[model samples]
Target: MRTIIENATLILPEGILKNGFAVCTDSIISQIGEGPFGKYNDSDMVIDAKGNYVSPGFIDMHTHGAGGHDFMDNTVEAYLGAARTHARYGTTSLVPTTLTSTTEELLNTFTIYEQAKEQNTDGADFLGLHLEGPYFAYNQRGAQDPEYLRNPEPEEYNLILAHGEKHIIRWSMAPELDGALELGRLLRSKGILASLGHTDALYEEVTEAYKNGFTHVTHLYSCMSTITRRNAYRYAGAVEATYMIDDMSVEIIADGIHLPKSLLQYVCKFKSIDNIALCTDSMRAAGMPDGEYILGSRDKGQVVVVEDGVAKLPDRSAFAGSVATADRLVRTMVEVAGISLSDAIKMITRNPARILGVDKTKGSLESGKDADIVIFDSDIAVQTTIVKGKVIYTQNNNLKS
Candidate 1:
């Protein structure tokens, strides 16, 4: 049976569609256009959007967890809880990120991730795992457990490849570190996205890393390199290099607290929405009341505190993570950065989907793509979320699943 969402202001790739309707046959968007798409048969389920702005459901490529559940829990329970929490905010798909931990721990995370994907829970779909650590620059390691940080080791990586690379979609590391570039090439060859992050890599180093297949940057402008003086000489850092490299996609925490509004606008000025993804980078603290929580694995996690709308290290020297969801990210882009709704939606949808290599199936509201959609009012508040062509969440009904 076909489901028709009529009377919507569609936010399409090219522009917006006022008084439009979209047709979803099962899980794919069969058609979308402006005007009253003709009268549908009773077999077709017609849902009125009430003239809301409809967009593709957000795809978060970088996130830890939410609802007091970390993905590192090594259990299906954590995955379901976190996924459902983010889905409530319109994330139709996401990659569960891992913290710096033992090789054994990372493998377990991949195993749990595979289980979640296979189970196909009602929350946002899981693409794969984002390996955020165990390969990084120790000096720039913010909120990451320093004990687990180190340069890339081939022996360990080879073991990971042999065991869990199939479940790994992206990997973040410090490009300047020894053996890191080789690791990036290996990850690329295996079809995993190699992202630069938690580093102090210079422009030249970053260029080398990109050439070696580090095509993405994690949490741009945070824990990344920028202008710095070295023995009276000023040099552009990885941050500037990312801006200069047109094709290197980058993600921002976009919760307004992780980065100031001016900095967010500056990033927008330099990078197109095509290369910028808005990620929550949220942790277990997200969707939970403000308080102290763990940032990684249960047995040996980093203690962090949530205050003033963001997570921070216990001592307050660095930020632990974000307590934001996808809706807050979209809202910040529109209200704080003064970005247009269509362009802002692109940041959370098309851009991340493209970077994560799931665009063919997930991003955009187009014919033949996955019917993952979100409908919102003028303030960018999500009124309803449709995942895989199913209305899984709604604001008016106070429903979440």
Candidate 2:
């Protein structure tokens, strides 16, 4: 069946088009224009958008879990539950992120990824899995399990390649670790994205890693060094690498609690919207009440609690993660970070899609692209989420009443 969403404020990366209509056939957009699109055809389902903002469905490049389910659980229910929760907030596609864990645990999680890949559960499309650890520097481990942190081993990489499905899109590693550059080169050979994060590497080391095919910086500024007059060499760390290299995409957790509002604005000013990707980096406690939650594995210990929208560990040293969704991240960028709505939307959608090398199919609302769309009211609240022309989430007025 075909669908025509009329009278919408179409939000695009370039700009917004008012009173536009998007026509989708099967699972791809067929047309977009400013018009009534004539009378709806016999086979068409016409939706009155009522002046709401319609944009490409968000693509979350980094996210752990939600709705009381962590990806580290390595269970089908956990993955699907997180997907459903994020989909309700306007995310159409997401990478299920994993934390530092043992080799056996990672292999077990990959099996779960295979299962989730095979099944479509009427929620956000599971783009792939993101391995965020086991190959990081222990000093900057953040919320990752310190016990499981280690240098990348070729045999372990080979094992992951053999058992892991092609859906493993990106892997995060500390470039300074032994054999990591070689592992990064191998990952690039297989078309998997290699990202640098959770490390205490200097500027020269980061530049060397970039030359070896590390094209992304995960969660910039967090678990990374800052530039100072006394520590200028350390400034050449991930932040400098991200700013200097145009091809390198940096992920930023826009939740106000993770980064100071002033610093977040400064980053956006240095890096164009095209070079910055917004990520939730959320954990199991996202979309739930404040309480203790687990991150990597059961044996890794509990993550801190959520209070006043900030997730902190018991010692208050660093943030465990965030409870914000992709939609909320965009909104926060606009409301707090002083960014335009269109630019913020691009950070979450087109920018991340381009970084993951899936922009042609999933990013924008261009003709011939996947019909993954989101409709939200004026207040930036998600009203409906559509994935591949199928309505996955719709607001229920009865519940609200």
Candidate 3:
């Protein structure tokens, strides 16, 4: 099938192109040019963008679940449902993430992920599985089950990796923990992304982590250390180390709530667009009404309340997770952090695709690339989402048959 989207402002890699058009042949982008497409036969599927911003579909590298279904729900239906929910908000590709859990639960998720992918239709394409951890610092393990948190165990991780090496794309953990450097090397050798998260590591530990293949920081500022005093001596923490490292990539939960405007601005001001990615870090309550919900698997997860646009523990002492969608993330960056639309879009698209090493085919709107596209208005409200040239979600039946 030939699909042409015309009369749009295309978000190209270099800059925005007004009155642009893109053509999709099968599942790949065949052409992108300025002005009208000139002629179209009845066989062609022409979509009028009405001057909306047509950009690469958002790629979320870290998201647990949405639409009342967590990936840890341990069912194919749950996986598909969450992906579908994010697609409606402009996510065309996403990595299904798992919270800290048992060895058995992690193994089961690996099996379930394989099953989910085989049946994933009408949803955002699954990039791969992101294991958020069974290894972390107890003091910094926010929202993660403390019962399962521990230092990296060579025997336990090696066993998990042996079974899941094929499906796992990335693993986040506290890099300062014992045996973490070895695990980082193992994951790197397997070409899996190793990232730092929920860590209380000092600058020196993070520097060592970088050499050991921990190239990314997960959810910067959230559950991560900043600066500390050790016997009246100030020491840099993971948060500060990220800025000094220069090449370290990081993802942030930019829900406006998880990070207030000032903190969001601070991150944007310090981090280059190429070195940053936006993630939802959302839970099952995303796209659902405010109320109580679970953070992981239905039976074993912790209970949290959803209100005030974010999820929190019942006592409201800490955030359990976010409820923001892909659109809200872009909106938060642009509207709250005062970032340009193009840069904010890049944080969710090209940056993540590059971080996950899938940039060659999925990140930008170029010919020969996957035709994963999203159309949104000035407000960053998603109007249509097309994954691999398939129009899965369109607002108000905007596209004609």
Candidate 4:
């Protein structure tokens, strides 16, 4: 099957191409060029972009759930349900993230993920799993359940690796905790991404953690320490170290609620578009109407409320999660943070794909790359989503066969 998208503004790695066209032969992009499109087979499925922007589909690296289903729901349906929901919002690739949970529950999720992935033909492709902690610090545990938070234990983590090594892509934890650096080393040895998150680590510890292979930061500026006083002596914290370090990549939940506009702009200014990726950090409430929901497994998760476009604890003490979608994140960065449309799209598409080590064929619009594309308008509203050359979701019925 051939899919052709023409007369659109293409977001390419170098820059935007006006009146560009892309030809997808099966799942791979066969050709891409600017100006008028050349001849094609009469049987080709051609889509006129109507002056909208055609770009690489978004890649979400740290999303927990969407469409009223969390990854920790421990069901195949829940996993695929969230993936499908994200796909509708321009996420062609996603890494299903887990919250702090029991070992048994984590193993169950691993089993379910394997099952769901086999049946995930109609949703966004699952890159892998991101284990977000049973290894975080207690005070920095934002919305993560405190019951499961603790220092890394070699025995328990090693057992987890034994069972879940193949499907685990990344793991986020507090690097300051006991045995955490060793855990980072173990993850690095296995080729899994080691990330710092939910921590109170100082600059020195963060520097050491980076050297030990913790090269990424999860949900930057959230659940991380800043400057603090230790015995009347002010010390730089993890947040400061993130800026001080030149090569460390970070993901931010650019939902406009979790982070204010000024802070988002500040991050973009310092981190640059290449080093910063955008994440939703969304919960089950994503794409759902404002209401009550669970943040993890139904039986053991905490109850949270979605209101004012963000999830929050019932007491309103802190943000439980975000209800933003991939499209919303791009829109927030462009409109709220004063970022250009091209750069904002990169944060959601190219940057995350690179951070997750899938940039060789997935991040941008190029010949011989996967046909994971999204068409959106000036407002960044996702009008069509094509995954692996298949028109998975379209707003105006633009698919032929």
Candidate 5:
């Protein structure tokens, strides 16, 4: 099937172009330009974009769960349910992240990815799995299970690599742990992204790890150490290393609660939109009203209640996860942080796509790229979300499909 979207304002790498027309043939975009359409046949389906903003679909690089479903459960339904909720919010691609768990549990979670990849739900495209635990510093475990936290083990790494079966795209770790650098090297050898997170490593350790192959940072300031003027040591903290390293990409939770609005603005000042990716780090409570929800597996701990956008544990620590969606993240960036709409969109779309190495297929609305696009009104509420040329979500007035 061929479809043509006419009379829309398209967002490109350079800037927004008014009065643009985009044509889609099956799953790939065929043409995008200004002016009259003379080459198309009469049978092609046409959608009047009505001057609305049309851009690449959002990509969530780090998300835990949604719709009362968690990836930690290691179930097919849980994965698909989370994907569906995110898709309705203009996210076309996402990585289902897992919390720290036992080796057996981690493998079980990896097996579920095969099922998610095989099934196509009417939600965001399941790009792959991101393992976010087990190799983290115990002090910065956040919501991860303390019992399961350990130093990197080559045997365990080999087991996961052997069974991952192409669905595992990234792994989050603490670089200061024993054998972590070697594990990072191994992950790089297998073409899997190694992300630094939940660490108390000095700046020198992080920089050395980056040289050894850690090219990404997970949830930049949440579980990482900050630099202080009093502790002017030889090694910089995670925060300092992140700012100094140009090649590394950093993920930030833009829900406003994780990091203060002022702090977020400061971080964005140093990190360009190209190197800073916006992630929800959302849990199962996302898209659901304020209520009780789980972060890690229920067996390891009880579910936390979400009150006023914070997911809190029993001890009353700040929410380790969030309820914000990708659409809301974009709006918050523009409305609160004072970032330009184009830069905010690039954080969710182009930046994440580039980090995941899927830019050619999923990043932008260019010809020959995948037809993953989102349409929204002036207020930025999602009106329609199309993935791979298929309309997965449509909103008409108060009604949704």
Candidate 6:
């Protein structure tokens, strides 16, 4: 099947193409150019984009769940609902994240992930699993279940690897923890992204971990550490170390609430667009009304409240997670961070795809890439989303066939 999207502004790799068009053939992009495509062939479906911006579909690298379902639920229904909910916000692909938990429960969730992928819920594609915790610094555990936090235990990680590392794209841990560098090496050997998060590591510790394979920093500035004074001596923390290391990459929640606009702009200015990726890090409360809910697995999660569209700890001390969708990420980057639309789009699309090592076929609207695309109006509101040449979401209607 072939579908042509015409009369739109396309956000392409080179730059923005005003009044452009793109042709999709089955599951791949066939052509993209400016002006009218001229008289095209028959047996094709044409869409009048009405000058909306056509961009590569947003790719969310970190998202727990949405639509009132948590991925840790270990049910196919929960995975599907989350996928559909994010698709409505232009997330064509996402990494289903897992909170800190016991090995048995984690394995069960991975099994559910395999099942969900095979079923193909027809929303955003589940790229792979992102094992977020069970190996983190107890002091900076943030919303994770602190009771289950511990250092990197070889036995547990070996068991997870035995389950097959192919199903996992990323794992986050505190680099300062004992035996963490060894675990980072092992994860790198298995082609997994070792990210630093929920930690109180200083600049030197982060540097040592980076050399061993911790190449990414998870949810920058959220649960991670920053500069502070000890005995009247200032020292660079994990956050500052990430900025200094050119090879180290980081992902931000970008909900505007997690970090102030000044911080967001500062990161962009220093880190460069290529090093940053936007993530939701959202929980089940996402896409649902404001209320109280659990932050991790339902049976053993921490109590959290959703107020003013953001999730917070029960006592309103720290953020539990974000309720933001992908579109919201883009909007916050543009409106609050004062970045260009093209750069903001790259943070969610091309940058993430590159980090996950799926850029060759997933990120851009270039020819020969997957036909995952999103059309949004000038205000950055998603109007239609196409995944693999099929329409998956539309603003006018709920979801597409």
lDDT (Cα atoms) of all candidates against the true structure: 0.88, 0.85, 0.94, 0.92, 0.85, 0.90
* Model 2, C-alpha of 292: deviation from truth (Å): 2.2
Task: Summarize candidate 4's per-residue lDDT along 18-67 as a digit string, tens digits.
Answer: 99999999999989998877877878998889889999999999999999
**TM-score (all chains, Cα) for each model:** 0.96, 0.95, 0.98, 0.98, 0.95, 0.97
Comparison by TM-score, 1 against 3, better one: 3
Q: Which of candidates 5 and 6 reaches a greater lDDT?
A: 6
Per-residue lDDT of model 2, residues 333-398, tens digit only: 998998898998898889889899899899898999999999998778998888998778877431
Question: Which clashing pairs does model 3 show?
Answer: none
Off by over 4 Å in 1: 396-401
Query: Candidate 6, residues 1-401: lDDT per residue as tens digits?
Result: 88899988999998898999999999999999889878766678788788889999999999999999899888999899999999989999999999988889988887888889988647899999999988888778888888789888788888888885879999998989898999999989988999999989999999999999999999998788889899999999998999999978899989988888999998998897999999999999888999988877778777899997799988888889999999999999999999999999999999999998899999999999999999998788889999999888876543211
**On residues 1-401, what C-alpha lDDT tens digit does candidate 1 reach at each position?**
68788889999988998999998899899999888889667687777788888899999998899999998878888898898888888889989999888989877777787888877658888888888988888778888888888888899899988888888899899999899989999988889999999999999999999999999999998888899999999999999999999999999999999889999999999987789889999999888899999987677787899999999898998888999999899899999999988888999999888888898998899999999998888877788888888877876542211
Among all windows of 10 consecutive residues in model 5, the one with the lowest summed lDDT is 392-401
Query: Could you tell me the TM-score of candidate 5?
Result: 0.95
So what's the TM-score on candidate 2?
0.95
Q: Write the per-residue lDDT of candidate 3 for residues 137-206, one digit (tens) a residue.
A: 9999889989988888889998998899999999999999999999999999998999999999999999
For candidate 2, what is the lDDT?
Answer: 0.85
Total backbone clashes of candidate 2, pairs 3 or more residues apart or in separate chains: 0
Model 2: C-alpha RMSD to truth? Answer: 2.6
lDDT of candidate 1 at residue 314, scale 0 to 100: 87
Clashes (candidate 5): 1
**Candidate 4 lDDT score at position 250:** 96
